[model samples]
Target: MRTKSEARKDAIMSVALEVFREVGFDAASMSQIAARVGGSKATLYNYFSSKEELLLEAMLHSAEQHAENVLQLLQTEGDFSQQLHSFVASLLTLVNAPETVEILRVAISVGGTTDVGRRFYESGTQHVWTEISSKLQEEIKKGSLRDVDADRMAMHLRCLCEAEMIRNLLGAHQRMSASEAREKADCIIDIFLHAYGSTR
Candidate 1:
């Protein structure tokens, strides 16, 4: 069970995310977040020292929720292809959401100019990749996957799953529907299984 402090902190993050999404990171202020959170600026500061800190925590909170869903799918007992398809579909749906796209745009726009990008990568993307890589390592030990670097394999899988869709998203193309995401995920998993399925 979460302690009162932890629950309150989560509440603050929830409101902070809403405020950030409304005005974006650059334009968003701690006062704005505090207003939405129903607290004084001092109270908000007790939970998060700076807007940047709050932003990172809020982003991590969202990413962690999606990561948990994906990790659960990855750990499920099932056919490898089925599991891969589920994971890919979940990932694509999460990444293609309008809020997520906006967040990515904000991150990219400020990535080179601030440490926010690095923090986001380390806490969000790298963390998910690490978890997925560990699962791949388990499959390798079970002789169900090719004997390869788990980290590299995980990266390859993500790249394949997001390939054209990510490109189209960055290019301002129409967002993929749920059905299209599933179809693309299936195609990517098929190719991945073909290339990396155990030789034995």
Candidate 2:
């Protein structure tokens, strides 16, 4: 079902991710990845234009499944507050994942001097936040939420969801269990609703 080219590319991305995690973006080199993949540097170049591109692609591939699950959770129908709680819980799980946290560190570290940070945000983070903003806008129209900026409200919710993310990135996070995540989500939703719940 899978072509050899596809398989080879997957292998390359897998090795690249491992190398990036091991040494970070600055210390990682194309040659090191090529060696790990048992391929020539030229072959590696054919797959990815640069080390930064490879890092982004590899990290994205690694986190794709979890991100999709989180997004899918967002689409499930529920009471607005319940939906927000579920979304927050799912998001916390995703962000606290080891691979996801590593990618975030990579983004923050390289973002100051390179396009990788901007591109990574635009590619994934922006899309997720936009979905949240859209949900907020719908609730605002229904007068369930206060009539404030949907984007800003979404930003607030995201901030709440990731309140512990820095600890994860620093390898200091204690990953939450399902009950713990749900409880944390409840706290976040309560704060958000307290601030934005309509007075009706």
Look at candidate 2 and give me any clashing residue pairs.
none
The best candidate by lDDT is 2
lDDT, residue 183, candidate 1: 88
Give me the runs in candidate 1 sitting further than 4 Å from their true place.
164-173
Structural RMSD, model 1: 1.9
Candidate 1 residue-wise lDDT, 55-110, digit = tens: 88888888898788877998888787788788899888777777777777667766
Per-prediction TM-score to the true structure, in the order listed:
0.91, 0.86
Error of 1 at 87 (Å): 0.9
Name model 2 segments beyond 4 Å from true: 1-4, 62-64
TM-score for model 2?
Answer: 0.86
User: In candidate 1, how many Å is residue 165 off?
Assistant: 6.3
CA error at residue 132 for candidate 1, angstroms: 1.0
